[model samples]
Target: MLVSVKELHQQTNLGDVHKEKPKKFDHLILGPAAGEGLPDRLQCQGIKALNKIHFGMSRNNSRSIDPVAFVTVFTIYNSTVESRPVDLVTVGNISYNKVKRSLAILNVFINFIQVNMPQSKVIILTDPASELPLQKDMVTIKPIQGEYSRDKLMLQRIRSYIAFLETRLEKLSQKQEQFTHFIFTDSDIAVIDDLGQIFIDYPNFDLALTFRNNKEQPLNSGFIAVRGTAEGIQRGKAFLQEVLKVYSSKFMKASRMLGDQLALAWVVRSNPNFNVRRFSRREAFLDKIGGASVLFLPCSSYNWTPPEGAGQFHGMPLDVKVVHFKGSRKRLMLESWNFFSSSSDLSDTLCLILKSGRTKYDF
Candidate 1:
C-alpha cells in the first residue's frame, strides 16, 4: 500500500492536491524508491503553497535509487500553516517567511544527505501536504493527523513527537525486510559527510543520540539513531509515553514555555540504564561525562550548534559537520541557508568537492 505522492493524490483526491504526476527528482547520492508497505497519511493540508514555490526542485532527477538498501533515515516536518499556527516576525515584503525558510532548509538538508550517504533510504514523515519531488531514495509520509490547535502550540508539538515515534516504530516493525538500522533527525540539519557508519557503529545500543555544549546544555534530541529490536521495543514506546507524562506535569505547565529538549532531558535522566550512547566529535562530552574511556565519536560535525549567549552574527564553526540552527535562532536560519546555498562547493553535489580536498567554508 506504500505509494508515491502521485498515487496518494490520485487515489484520495484530498485537499488541494496536484493530479499531475511529480517530475522525477535528481538526487545527490542515488538509490531506489522503498517498495515496502510504508503508509503515508495524506491530509493535504498545505501542498498548494509548496507547489507554487517549486520549493525543492528536481535535484535528483538524473539519478535512480536501488530499493533494497540496508540503511534508512527518518525525519519529520510539521509547519505552522500545515501543523500549527505561530506568529513569527517577518521583515521586508516576504509573506510566510518562516515557512519559506523551513522549506529551503529542508531542501538543502535532504540534498546533503543524498550526496554524502548514498546507500541510505530517507523517509520524511510530515503532516503537511507537500509536493517536494522525491529525492532519490527519499519518501514523504503523512503518518497521522497532526495536532492543529494554536492555543497551546508547545503542547501540540509534544503530542506530535509522541505520535511520530509510535507510528514510525509500528511501520518499521511491519517493514523489517527493507532496513537494518534507522537514523532519525530534525529537518533543520545540514549534514556534511557520509553517515553510513552511524547505522552499524553501535550494534548493541538501542539508540544513539547527538549532543552539544556539555557544560551548559546536556543533550539535544535533534538527531537520534535507533536500533530496531523487538525485545527492547516496548521500552522505546514506554520512553515516549514517559516523555508525555513529564511534559504534561504541573511543573512543565507552570513553566513559561516548555520544549522537547526538557522532555528529552527527562528521558535521559530517567533511563540512565538504557542502552543509549552519546555521539559527538568534540572532547567536551568526554570531559563532562567523567571521561568514559570507550571510543566515542566526535559528533560535533553532525550536531553542530552555534555558540549560545553570544551577540548576533556569532557565525558558524569552521569544522561543523551539521549546522542545526536551533529553534531559538530562527533568524540565523536564513543566514545559514544563504551561506550554503551560494557557496559553489557542497560536499555531495559535485564529485569535485570530495571530502579530502574541499576547503572548510566557515561562517
Candidate 2:
C-alpha cells in the first residue's frame, strides 16, 4: 500500500532529479480544490489498504479515513541579518537568511509535503510582512497579528502555536469537524512519508512529542501531534499555557535563549503530575502529564537529523520519515533531498516503518 521513493518518482515522473536550481512551486496544486473533498478512490481505498497491508485493522473495526482528518501546520516569519544576532546569519540556514534563500527552502519543504501527502490540509502561520507564494487552494496561509522581532523568536512561535490550537478548539466547539488530528512542525522539516499512520497506530494519545537520545534535552519540540477531541484540545491548551508561564517566569531568565524548549522540558520533568515511562524495547516513552496522555516517539524515526560529514546518509535508517534540517544541517538536508530524489534504488521505507511487527502500540 505504501509506495517506495523510487516508485513515487516513477509514478509522478519526477524527471531530471539533478537540477541545480530548485523547481518553481507557484502553480503546483497536487490535490483537489479548496472545498472539493478527496478523490473517490482515496476516500474509499486509502485507510482500508493501510489497514490490510500495514496496521492489521480488520474491515469491521477500521474507521473511514478522511483526507481532511489530518492537518499539518507550519510557522515562518521574516527576519533579516541586521535584526538578528551575529551568530544567526548563514547561507544554509533559513532563520536569518535573506528573503530569497529563505523562501527557496520553504518552497522545497512545502513541495516535499505536497508530493508525499497531497491529500492532507496544510496551514501556514506567518507574519503579515512575510511573503509566501503558496496558492490559497493548495494551502491555507494565515497571518498572525504582531510585530516580528529577533529577540522574541521563540515567543513568536509559541504565540502562533497557541493561536493554531485555539482556532482548532473553537471549530471543535462549534461542531465544524474540519479535522481530527493536527501536526505542528517547524518549517525546516522535510516530510518524507505519510504521517496519517501515526494517528491510526497511536489512536488513544492526546499529545505526541518527539525525543532525542540526549538526557539533558530529551525532548525536541519540532514535531508535535495533537488529537482534536474535546479533552485532548483542552489538555493541550493547558499544557502549552503552563509552558508559556514557565518560559516567562523569572527563574528561566538565565537560559531564556533556549526559550520554549527549556520551559517544555521543565514542565514535563519537574511537574509533580507528570509520570514518564520508557519503553523497555524501543526508544519510545509514554508520559502522563496532568491526566493527559503524552506519547514520546523517538527522534530517530520522526525527527531524524543527518550526522556530520559528507555521505553520512549511509547511516540513516530506511524507515526515517520526517527529517529536520536544524541549524547548519539545512545544507545537508538539501543535499540529501537531491540525493534521495535522484537515487533509484531506494525502497518503500514507509511500509517497512509501519508494519505491525516493526512497531508495537501496547501503551
Candidate 3:
C-alpha cells in the first residue's frame, strides 16, 4: 500500500481549470484570526460579507522605502467554537491588559520587521474591526468577512482555514498579480529572524511548510508557504479544491481531527513534482519520516518551542528564528514581546547561549 510521489501527484491535472491570468500577491504572509479573542460564539450570524478598512495604504500613497509585502490574515468566524484560548481578549468584552500584552507581542515582531527587514511591507489581516490596537506604520489591513457552516467539523474553527485555502488559491490561479509567494502562519508566534531568505534561496518549491505528527500525511497547515508561479499556483489551487471536495467524506470524519491541515498534507505528499523546499542545512533532516519527503527545516530554527517550563529559554536546543509560544500563554506572551521590544533581540539571545557555555539557563 505504499504510495510513491508519482501516484501522489499523478492526477493533479484533473481539477477545475480557472483562467490563468489575474492579479496575485507577492511576499504575502497571512494567517487566520477570525475570532481569536472574541467572547461570544457568533454562529453564522453575519456571514457572506467582509467589512474592510485600508489604513495608510492606497494605490497612490507612496512611501520613501517600499517594505516587504507580508500579510497577517484574521477571521471572526460564524461558528460557536473556540479552538484556542483567548490570550488577547477577555470574556464578554475586550480586556485592556490582554490587549496591551498581545499588541506588545505583535509589536515586537512588527517592530523587528520594520527595523531589520526595512523593505518587507507587512500587511495585517483580521476580522472586520476587532478593535485591537495594531501598529500603523509600514502596515496595511486586509479584512476578510465570510459566512460558514458551524455544525461541520465538530467545533474546530478550521472553516476559515478551508475558506482561505479556496479563496486565496483560486485568486492566485487566476493570475492574481501582486505578490510573488505566500506564507500562512499562526498568530501567536513572533519572528526573531528573517525567513524571507528561505523563499529566495529555494525558489523552485511550489509549497514549503513545516512537519508535525512525526512527518505524517498532513503537514502543519498553520505554517505553509506557496510559490505564486503558474504551475505553483495551479498545484496549490488543485490541492485546496480537493480538500473541499472530500471535506465531509468518511476519511476526514473518521480521523476526528483532519482539517485543512491534513487535506494539504495529503496533496503535497501525494504530488511528486510539487518541488518542495526544505532547509538547506543538514540539521533540518535530523527527524525525517520515511514517506514524507520535504525539505524538513529544523524545528529549532523555524518553529522553536520551549523544552520545559513556561517562557524560560534557559536551555534552547537550536538557533531559533521564531518562537511559536505554544505553551504557558501569559509567560510566552510577555517574554516574546520583551525579547524583541528591549534591545536584546537575536544578537543578545545568541550571546547568552555562548556565555552560558551551552548549559541551559536556570531562570
Candidate 4:
C-alpha cells in the first residue's frame, strides 16, 4: 500500500509526534509534492492560488509562470532527522520545459528526502519573481539581484545563472549561524537514496563534490554539498562561478560538447576550500545496470543526450541511483526512455517528452 503523508511522518520522525502541523515553513518551491501520485484538485487549486499571490505581489516588470508548471508543497517526511542531516537547497533557472521536468524531479527528490533525511530543510533559490511558495518545511528565497542574458550564446544563460547561485551563496555565508551546511543540487537530478550516511560516515571531507570518471576532470555538476564555515562557503561559491565562466565560455565559443561537468571541475580546481572526492558513477545513473545502484554519477549519463548504448558498461550491475534527464536532447531521451522497464516511471515521463518534443513543458 502506498503511504499517506501522515503515515510518512509517523514512520520517519524520531521526535515527538505532537508537534503542530508545520504551517510555517522553512522553504518552498514550485515543484511536486512527496508522493507517487500526481497532484489532486485541491493541490491544483493551491498551486493556482500560490501563483496568483506570487504574481500579484510582483513588481510591474515581474515574470510569470503557469500555475501547473510549479507545484507548491511542504516538508517531505521520508528523510529521518538522525539519518540524513543537513540543510537542503536547489538552484535552477525557470523555463516552461525545465519547470515541468523539474517538478517531476522534485517529486522523486521529496520522496527521497522523506524516506531518508527527515531533519533537513529544503530551500529553493532562483531568479527573482520566479513564482515559488513557502511550504511546511521548505521555503523559497529569491536572490538579491542578478541578470539573465538572452544572447545567442550556448550554455551562457545556464552558466550565468549558476554563477548567480554562487554569488548569492557567498552572501549567505556571512550569516552562517542560520544554517549548518548548505547543499546545491540541480533540478534535473534526483536523489535515489539517503545521503546522510555518506556525510556522517566520512571524515576529513569539507565538501562533497560530484565529478565524471576520475580522470581529474569535472563532468557532472548535479550535486554539491558545501560546508557552512565562512571560508568553506566562499570557496564553494568561487569554485562554481569561475568554473561556470570558463566552461560556459568554452561551450559558447566552440559549440563543443563540454557541458556542466568540465565547468564544475574548473570550479573545484580553482576553489581552495574544496576537497573533491569521487563516488560510484554507476550509482548515479538512473537506469538499473547491475544489482548495485549507480551513485557517483558520470557527466555523460547526467546530461541531455541521445540514448546510445555507448555509455553503459554491459558487464556492470543494474542499479540506478540518480538520473539527470536534461531537456535539451529530446530525441535521445526518447530512445533511452524506452530501454528501461515499465517499472521505471521515468519511461512514462520519457514518453511524455517524446510525444511532445521541443514543445515546452508538459509533465
Count of clashing residue pairs in every prediction: 18, 1, 34, 37
TM-score of each: 0.53, 0.66, 0.54, 0.45
lDDT of 2 by residue, 25-79 (tens): 2111122111112232111121122211121232223245434232333334444
**Tens digits of lDDT, candidate 4, 168-237:** 4666665533535555565544333334443333423444554444554445544555555455545545
On TM-score, the candidate that comes out on top is 2
Question: How many backbone overlaps does candidate 3 show?
Answer: 34
Between 2 and 4, whose TM-score is larger?
2
The candidate, 3 or 4, that scores higher on TM-score is 3
The sequence of per-residue lDDT tens digits that candidate 1 reaches over residues 1-363 is 113445534644655446765332211111122211222211111111101111111233213322212221222334335423343334223333345555555665666666545555566554454344445445444444555344354455445555655665676688845433455576666565444444334444445555544533345656655455543233445654665677677335533344556765655555445333342224423121111111233444456544331111222223344555554444344333343456544422111111111111111
TM-score of 3: 0.54
RMSD each, Å: 17.2, 13.0, 19.3, 19.9
Clashing pairs in 2: 4-348
Q: Relative to the true structure, how large is the alpha-carbon lDDT of every model?
A: 0.42, 0.56, 0.43, 0.37
The TM-score that candidate 1 achieves is: 0.53
RMSD of 3: 19.3
Residue-level lDDT tens digits of model 3 in 1-363 = 112224434533456447643222111111122322233211111211122211122123323322235555543332334334433333113332434544555665566556545556666555554544565777766654543233343213344444555565667667674545555566555555556665555645655556533344325444555555556545554544555554545245533354555565555545655433442232443222222223445454566544322112333333346556443333334433444345444544332222222122111
Q: Give the distance in Å from residue 58's predicted Cα in candidate 3 to where it truly belongs.
A: 28
